[model samples]
Target: MLSRRLALAVATGAVAALALGTAAQAAPARHGGHGATLRTLAERPDLLIGTAVDASALAADAPYRAGVSSEFSSVTAENAMKWEVVEPARGSYDWSQADRLVEFAHRHHQEVRGHTLVWHNQLPAWLTSGVADGSIDAAGLRAVLRKHITDEVRHFKGEIYQWDVVNEVFDEDGTYRDSLWLRELGPSYISDAFRWAHEADPKAKLFLNDYNVEGVNAKSTAYYELAKKLRAQGVPVQGLGIQGHLDIQYGFPGDVGDNLARFDALGMQTAFTEIDVRMTLPADEAKLARQAQDYRRLLDACVAVRGCTSFTVWGFSDKYSWVPDTFSGQGAANITDENFVRKPAYTALADGLRAAARRAGRH
Candidate 1:
């Protein structure tokens, strides 16, 4: 059976808490262009708003798509580094999709974040069942895993500003997930992944990404201990990726500001990564209002925490979200409906940002 940590990782690939900023300023709306959100938001140095772009978005010749996403300064691809895309046939490699995404970032003059170098979900069938059947022992798994991380990082060196070196390795029970990494090489595989990534590209900031860490729980507690220990061991881990895939059914964090501050106090940067608050099937006004409030609370926490750097929604619009179909009875997560109109959550986030700016000025 898979460990709780591994189960959660498969369930939610998630969090980063970083409030990197210079000064607060209102972002100017773009009239028209073809670029990701960060390309537009990079206009002002104070705020960092971002979103994950699908490969299809880049393919489509949408009108002024850049305008809708202009208030962001950083870009993270949703699935560019998954195992299937990076190592489709175990040894054979394909860099076409990732290469195009990087080129798009360069063309628009935006900083790119490598979604991940290590994950359990998107691994190739060879490794998944191979490890299951004992065809690949611990030593064999370690060799393959390390090589994959090192090569991916080296290939995208200098282009990606930050790399999610080790992603979704913890379970909600605060234990290391029982993944191929755990089953084969044991828990040390995670530290090795981070170390290898650092060796591949020292300039790239390494992050441990996971979901459901927004509030204090067994999972986040384990992350806190891991991060603290890694820092003590002089590991290259730099940031935490908080996959904020919230649900209105469950109450939002009551002390979000304090949670962020606690992480910031630990000397780690925080980022609102993969943020999307969902509602039960057949969304209603009450749920939408709750979702808006949840979004506001998250943004307010980011603004209040000095070290919070980036805030990225999983996707810009609900039309492209992976949630509705992935999770039955769960819909209405993105800032826009399927039709592309701004939802209450979007307005609430912008409003919270403005409030944060005003409060920052007062300070």
Candidate 2:
């Protein structure tokens, strides 16, 4: 059986499959464009087209590296920057993999998004065990948390453009998820995490990121209230990251524009952080077409909102997606297929960006 963490990692894939099946339909053609790279199309509007990348893939996968460099203007380390990989042992740290990714992004002139200073999943065993064993007290945990955030942020202070200070802190129903942080450090941990990250690197934009909050729903409402409260208290919270992990079956987020607008109204920048539209196995033309439509809708939502500056796919190609393993019988959730072939969704993204560019009078 898959561990709950792995299951949650791909939970969005399952959610996509369930939510979109009945709504899957042919998407109408809105625009036509050819051979436009995401970077070029986004340049005119000052929008950043980015992707989450596995660090090993950056060094080992030639074609994947080329694809990323040629297309995206920003990159986020999918797992390398997470707590498990960065600080597996108490008071010990490793920066090899994360450093490699930051170096690669700088070499390619791509900005970096530091993923997650605080998350419940993917935590180092020692930290969780300490909590579980009662060896680490609440005050000790708070000190440890501060050390982790400060050290990580300080190490990459100028290199990373943004930091996801807190990730997936809320449950789907708008309540705080019962994580170790909340249990030990309480609700103040969230605000403390953001403040610590900011103090470490005052220039890096700090954000709270979550999935299933892309539309104007209960989950998003939670974020809106939190953003408003954080700002009122003068927390260094700057942005909201909506991980747009779409599945063809769930249909597109209809109220995405309104949801983004609400966040923007609170003086916060918003971003489509991790986007991918997946479908069940044995993908057909209609499924692919619907995926294309979903992709377009997400990009359109970001473009329609001011201060919605960045749009990043979870990963660019289906070859390395975490979907299939996490969601049985479901795969191909990315814009490109396994062989680096441009799928319909790829063209749809280009078309959307091109249209946005033209509308902004960049063409």
Candidate 3:
């Protein structure tokens, strides 16, 4: 069997090259007189550019669908793969929306990254209630969690490339979040989740994904220690996903490359799983330009890391972004405008990808 790193590299190069080549061929009809298409800029063999997409948008919005299909080599479901959507009730599962997104990805010749398997948020009432009341004890909750991970992983065994097995489990101060899982199942919940997910689908890369861990700080240090400990204990954790949700207000993370390098040294692949550089309302030329710079820097950081195989935007277009809804006065986080027109940030990303491809070519 090929080593994990070799297997990942080969898969990434083959998929990205094929996707870029196909997209480049279709650029004229799709993008018309637009400068360089995202695919054209991402004609690199070793890296995959991706975006999260809503299932409804994929089905109903032609422009959204076309932009996603042509610009990205990988697709992540924004909400379909969440626990609430997958298992809304105890033992009752729904796969319709998730399956739609997966099928859409397959049709576009793009790999699918499962958004998440275990998270503190987006939990169904049934599961949370079981945890709240005495209905589901510690052991019962553990069993339910295992089943959820196993069933979900098994269902999408060969379809998904990676899964955020345990998401945002740590707090900002380097401590475990007092989530339902932590409260009931204890800290071993994270390791158990990874193991269960691996048992269900040994081939899929299991990742610990989180926000605010893009830079070397307390939270990321927590991840570094936990990842080291897990690997030392022979856990199946294979990747670290830094959710690069940047805001112009807070400025960009300065040590993103170093942060990725530290995780890469732990024998784990790193990915910018959910990237979006948002700005305050009423975007101006200067703000857009700064966003472009931020986007470029982020791509630069990812490409500079050998183990960073994927860079995924949270969503491709501002029309479907979660920024405005989640954070008041913060919007326009995507590379595309509401009309599916490429923004300056999009150009910066394309240019960064092209430069990274050239750098990779030299090596």
Candidate 4:
């Protein structure tokens, strides 16, 4: 089972080492001038500024650990908490990588964001195969899912502050995603997920996280409707997580503030869950400068909104960015370069928070 686990992880990540040269282990631990970290610059103490952590990087890479501990107030297990990594086999679950991330966060006084409980991607081969081949029936699959949520949540009950319970469950057209869960259990699976997660850890704030819903689009509107319906039915849904994966080429999502406000009006908490403004490859200073402005705009919107809580970057450094591997010729998606040097975008983010602090009568 562990062999199966190792094989799956290797299959997905074998290209990272080649794509990204040797680790930035030599990068100095300290960042920014005068020790004005994001944690300290954040005038709103409740606002958590964070980045996702790759477990292998966190383990073998010193600079990586330094970046996470020195900068962020929160950390999300990038892939460690996903089903494939945690439960590689049906009955075999490995919490070592995820547990290390949690323990590391604890030692550094950082809260953890439990990445996902329900997602179509990164599912165990066994689970997916069983479902595809009819070995796992609807009722049986539901029970299996319940066990996962219950065991995983209970395992890390007090450690995690927010759980991206159901991720990317909606399509871009405001329709339910054609996921394994949707295929088996239908749309009710969404609410069922929230209920099961709540039953496991009553205190952990639950969020429905998705990308392409950063603005008031059809996708986001669909989420708003679903959240409203779930609330009406007394489901314990607490947050709407907008994954702000922006591309500088597309300009900024100007309506982000209004979208957050609508969810806020629903007595729901909203977060810019994953904020990264990427650009086309061979990035010039001009493109980087535009990236800075785009980053500032998103942060400013969150700082202005009452219900906007955590602002998390997908990853903090270009060296470990997932952009290039996933998107051809798009790599500069983080606040820092390969050497861990802070970029213009990094300055813009800090300045945005400071600007928010200076603004009077923010209601």
The most accurate candidate by TM-score is 3
lDDT of 3 by residue, 69-183 (tens): 7787778989998989999878899999999888777666667888899999998899888778889899998998899999999999888788889999999999999998888
Off by over 4 Å in 3: 1-36
In candidate 1, residue 216 scores what lDDT? 74
Residue 141 CA displacement from its true place in model 3, Å: 0.5
The segments of candidate 4 whose C-alpha lies over 4 angstroms from its true place after superposition are 1-32, 360-363
lDDT value, residue 91 of candidate 1:
91
Clashing pairs counted in every model: 30, 5, 0, 0
lDDT of 1 by residue, 1-363 (tens): 122332342244221101111111112232122222232322224345777878776567352144233445557888877777878888999988888877765544346778887787788898888888989888888888888888888888888766777888988798788776776677887788889999998887778889988877778778878888988898877888788999888877666676677778889887788899888878888888999898888877777776777787888677788987889989889877775566788778766765565665732
The TM-score between candidate 4 and the true structure equals: 0.90
lDDT, each prediction = 0.71, 0.83, 0.84, 0.84
Flag regions of model 1 displaced more than 4 Å: 1-47, 61-71
lDDT of 4 by residue, 1-363 (tens): 012222333354444223222222234534555556675567454688899998889998788777787677789998999999999988898999999998887655567889999999999999999988999999999999999999999999877888999999889999999988998999888899999999999988999999988789999999999999999999999999988899988857759889999999999988888888888989899999999998888898888888888999999999899999999989899999987888999999888876777784332
